[model samples]
Target: AVLTKGVTPINFKPEFADADAAEGEDTDPHAFQSVANAKIYVKNIADAFCTADAEGCDTYKANAAVYTEKLDALEGDVRTAIQSVPQEKRVVITSHDAFGYFEKAYGLTFLAPEGVSTESEPSAADVAKLVSQVKQDKAAAVFVENIVNARLIEQIASETGVKVGGTLYSDALSQPDGPASSYIDLMHNNIAQIKGAILGS
Candidate 1:
């Protein structure tokens, strides 16, 4: 229920956790959950404003239109960059299962030894399984997220014989001076890191 494809959002209190749980409700726990998958966010905001003031709503819609265009252009650039790499060299490893949306949108493969959150420590078996997967799939390189410890990824790279790709911004944006300080910059930086590591150009 993380995403409902533009459905109205559900509001609940933390104290009502049990009330939010629905048994037998089929869901993809690992489904893509990112700003990319929430493309309706701006539209929803605009629509909410329309309920208050129609005139002001037009302004929101206009702003959303500009943002949508920027997002489209960003996707195009990322797609082109990924396409430049050979299919066999396109695979990547990250710290966690965060790029499901990007992978589905852009058609690149991403393997992770951890789950969505960095707070949870990955088991040794999980690391071994990911290492085996990296070797079998011939993953291009492993990249550490800015928010996670880099040791695990370095270990994976050491064992898999793949180079450490680079750092990627995951949960939050970096400081203004950092490479991935903005949304568009984050996309460009990630693509540059992956392409540089895989294609070495």
Candidate 2:
């Protein structure tokens, strides 16, 4: 409120069906997890810029077009990579519910103990429930995130008799020397880890 005291913030959060309820719907902010939604976000950004500065509209549109072309290619790559794995084997377990948008867009299932907010802690029952769900769902892989604690994911994997697959960059990119150093790399690295682990298992 303090930061936006004299300005209006444009919100581009994509709404999902089952995720809406009381408490004003626990929306997930990580919409960029999916390239499609990322394109929408880019469009929104471009539109906002054009509205705020008419002289820069053409530049913004041009830049957004160039970038979204790359995003389109990335989308194809993601689909082809994920499609190589069987539909039933596309389940993933992560530290939090950061991949809801990714799951919706990619036809994969992502289970997490904590909700959208990373600060929320799950109870013992919550962890137990997730462990059971992992076993029942035949989860393909359990992954640690660059932004969250890995102990919960490790425990879930251990209980389900699967190893922690790999590190996935969720809310942040990695260092320059790391695998997920950029948005495109982050998506590529995540899908590669998921596909390789699931197929190998």
- TM-score per candidate, chains pooled: 0.73, 0.75
Off by over 4 Å in 1: 1-38, 114-131
- In candidate 1, the residue pairs with backbone N, CA or C atoms under 3 Å apart (3 or more residues apart, or in different chains) clash, namely none
Error of 1 at 88 (Å): 1.4
Itemize residue pairs with steric clashes in candidate 2.
Answer: none
lDDT of each: 0.68, 0.74
Candidate whose lDDT is highest: 2
Tell me, by TM-score, which candidate is best.
2
lDDT of 2 by residue, 1-201 (tens): 122222222222233222333335455667778787777777888888888899999999999999999999999999999899898888777665567768778898876543333345556776787787788878888888876777777777777776577887778988999999989899999888888878874
User: Which parts of model 2 are misplaced by more than 4 Å?
Assistant: 1-25, 113-131
Candidate 1, residue 103: how far the Cα is off, in Å? 1.2
- Candidate 1 per-residue C-alpha lDDT over 1-201 given as tens digits, one digit per residue, 9 for 90 to 100: 123455433222222223223322222232212345445665666677777788788788898889878877876788889899998887887765456566666777776553323344557776687688788878998898787788778777887778788887756778999998987788788889989988866
